[model samples]
Target: MVPKVPIDLPGTRYHKARVAADALRQQLTQIIEERRIALRNGRASAEQDLLSFLLSNGSDEEERGLTDDEIKDNIILLLYAGHDTSSSTLTSLFKFLAENPHCYDQVLREQLKVASSKEEGELLEWKDLQRMKYTWRVVQETLRLLPPAQGGFRKAIKDFTYSGFTIPKGWKAYWTVNATHFNSKYFINPKKFDPSRFEGAGPAPYTFVPFGGGLRICPGNEFARVEILVFLHNVLKNFRWNLVDPDEKIIIDPMPLPLKGLPIKLIPHSK
Candidate 1:
């Protein structure tokens, strides 16, 4: 059985977590310092990446800029949020595709159609991204099943009643994506993996929120979509792989990850 103690409790796990966190903080500080130097040398542009954007001059004199520590904090947030979510989504997606070969073939066919339209050695552009309909549907289905951000928190702006409970002002509100994803009212056979659910207008506005919704919707949603699709296009076009341990289970220590780290055997595609 797993230990049921809180993370803050003094224990080996807590010590390890603290050490890992400090190491990560150090690394991020180093990266922030390097970017500051690059900016000083004019080797990097303000519009380049998230780091550059944060380090850029404010739009107007009234706009205050971020401190070096603040910039590092934002970098840590993105590195923590953006990296794991996409990586986990991709891992789960590939696992699903490998298990469902028919879906894999369908996705492969659609991707190949997109590939044929592009010139040799040319990179995918906005048009290519728009054409990846089926693949995106598959991605949606995967996200619904195993959202990287299982849920998030929001602070109540004022006193309100929800589901008959009077929530006082200053209380925190939480929403779980699973509530909708697993509900029969919102999904037909919620347990089944049906990409068709996303074929048309898809689930109602807030009902299928793998990436939260409304004002707090993930700012990087489009970036994540482009990143995942581009990755799929490249990998599926050049290689195929089989799971080394088909029976491996997914666990959520904090983020969803295959218990065995998703070991696989790669097979290169013939030209």
Candidate 2:
């Protein structure tokens, strides 16, 4: 997407984004300093979590240890890639399920089957998530239709030709996820929402990449999967919802978002 203003002019989206970024960086810096102090004071354990681990092991004497800024940047990336993207996918999933009753029913049935197998008040485990094939297919379809990230930028490894166009070895290229996702060559009736597309062999090797492909692919992809499936399982098992506006418009500010935040009326399942 292109910025409306060349500079961070007042009252512009670019300026607002800069303000938010600065606030986030400041907040993360404070948290990092507090954690570092706690670690030095023996008030926190190095094994507590990722932040603590990074702080504990980051020694200036070691050549490979991450700098404070590096640690902060990594944390920011994880928050956006792991948290924001998952939230977007979940929101879109809810909207789609509400619009398509048949798909909603199938997802509910699949989730209930998984729930029924668990003991009362039992927590969902990794293996339980693995059994949620159909539910995941639904999620996959959601990702395909409304990927959290529109796409990413990559550099050409070497000169290559595709569709008779030659790309230079070092030129930076931008790829759009929707373009690949909506291609009829890779997907049948690409505009249609079909979870069955992921049934067997799934979309071709590099085609179904909500998470980018190859070594540069998202590292938090599996974490997002578990997070999404677990949330869907619990929510579907306990509640039924209907979209307040079935025809809500999706707009991409950066990622796809409902114009009205996907307003919904939730009905709790009867005990």
Which candidate should be chosen as best, given TM-score against the real structure? 2
**Cα lDDT of all candidates, in order?**
0.87, 0.89
Per-candidate TM-scores read 0.88, 0.92
Give RMSD to native, each candidate: 3.4, 2.2
| Model 2: residues with Cα > 4 Å off, grouped in runs | 1-6, 59-62
Clashing pairs in 2: none
- Return the lDDT, model 1, position 134: 95
- lDDT, candidate 2, 70-166, per-residue tens: 8878888887878889999999999888888899999899899999999999999999999999989999999998988988888998999888989
Taking all chains together, the TM-score of candidate 1 against the true structure is: 0.88
- Tens-place lDDT per residue, model 1, 86-136, is 999999998989888888889999999999998999999988999999999
Q: Which stretches of candidate 1 lie over 4 Å from their true place?
A: 1-9, 12-15, 30-45, 58-63
Candidate 1 lDDT score at position 113 = 96
